[model samples]
Target: MRISALLIDDDPILRSGMKGLLSMVAPEVEIVAEAEDVQSGIAAIEKWKPQLIFLDIQLNDGTGFDVLEHFTQSTTRLESQVVFITAHEQYAVKAFRFSALDYLLKPVDPDDLRSVIEKVKKSQDDATGISHVELLLENIKRQTNSFKRIALTNSDGIHLFEIADIIRCESEDNYTTFYIRNNKPVLVSRTLKEFEELLRDHGFVRIHQSHLINLTFLKSYVKKNGGYVIMADQTHLPISQRNKERLQELITKTL
Candidate 1:
């Protein structure tokens, strides 16, 4: 399916470059509208109702957060998949990852942009984009503390879950299985490391290479034979020696 996308950035030169790159690498994504500031971006989104957006974190009048917040607070749901473009370093990129949002660095790498486009296409849950964006906006506003929702995508589709409901994640080679409350576990086509990167700061700990546990569901710590943890689900997972100290630290601070 051809994707109608909006470009929102303050720098005309960067926008021009990105447009050229998109035409070259992601021809399936057509630029439907362009805006240089928060107000114009919001207006473009309202008017065009594009399926995708290339948003700059910084704009002339206000930050991209302002634009997202406007859509989030609006009565009508915002129907768009956002891919943030920014020059900010580690912290901001971490923010996007934690929210499970796609983002590209400035001077937008062609391969990276292509990968992101492919991911968006594979998602196939366009109807839930608005809720995903809203969750992302909420996560950004609260940072690591308010990780209320998480998006998991697989062959079935994108599934959103309350952070508190997730018990733990078990690795299946390239895939990760998310164990949740009152629901069967979900197997997503992503690495345990990817989930670790996204969830580590949000009340999750990688106690072992194959396991990422939500501290909220931690039931007990077993201190025998390299140590292990008992989750609220009653499953026991080993704690790698490398991660043992850190896990203990987090456990002490958390509980």
Candidate 2:
């Protein structure tokens, strides 16, 4: 079967260029539709139901995680495989762990695209049409946003945190404290603002000046208590009344 694919990204140059790249490299793959943002992407996925999707981690409207939420929470099952295309270097390793069939870093090399396409095609051939999507979906959703890197410090020295074991980041007097999965919060040299700036590009958002929580690590939020968010590890963080509107906007825009 000719593999049908959808391309989603906000960069005009990259999006247009990528469509051309696919046409040249994987001639067998049909470009069925294109979406610049999450909602349209979701609509395209539902309409065309392509075999694969070339996705960008950031879109004008929201991040790739938002697009993913649509797929993960949808009633109509998604069977399309995903190929992540991104310019952000930090997210490469995270992409692989997220079970993306393939990834193309920005200013994509045609050769890389072709080689990965071949690999995916071979996997499809081996599967006799069945894919690992169902089995891997839960893990993908659970871990996609949980991967967080932290700069941990104590009386002795500095240490970089393991991404998977992170709990949350909280603003202190001048530093941002990292609360690990099971361990106590470790203060980092950089202020919470600095960390927020660093992570904002990677889907992290500030609910309150003192708290930068990963939406992917979210468990629940209280609407009545001036909106306090409860994370996956059951950590309660205050959401500033002023930022509540923007936070709600972000929450809606992502998923």
For lDDT, the strongest prediction is 1
TM-score of each: 0.83, 0.50
Reference-based lDDT, each prediction? 0.84, 0.70
* Per-residue lDDT of 173 in model 2: 88
Worst 10 residues of 2 by lDDT: 126-135
Clashes of each: 0, 1
Query: Considering summed lDDT, which 10 consecutive residues are worst modelled in model 1?
Result: 123-132
Q: In candidate 1, what are the lDDT values of residues 10-57, reduced to their tens digit?
A: 999998999899899989889988999999999999999888888999
Cα lDDT of model 2 by residue, 132-196, tens digit: 23323333444445543433434434355555555578877887677767676777545877667
Return the lDDT, model 2, position 89. Answer: 58
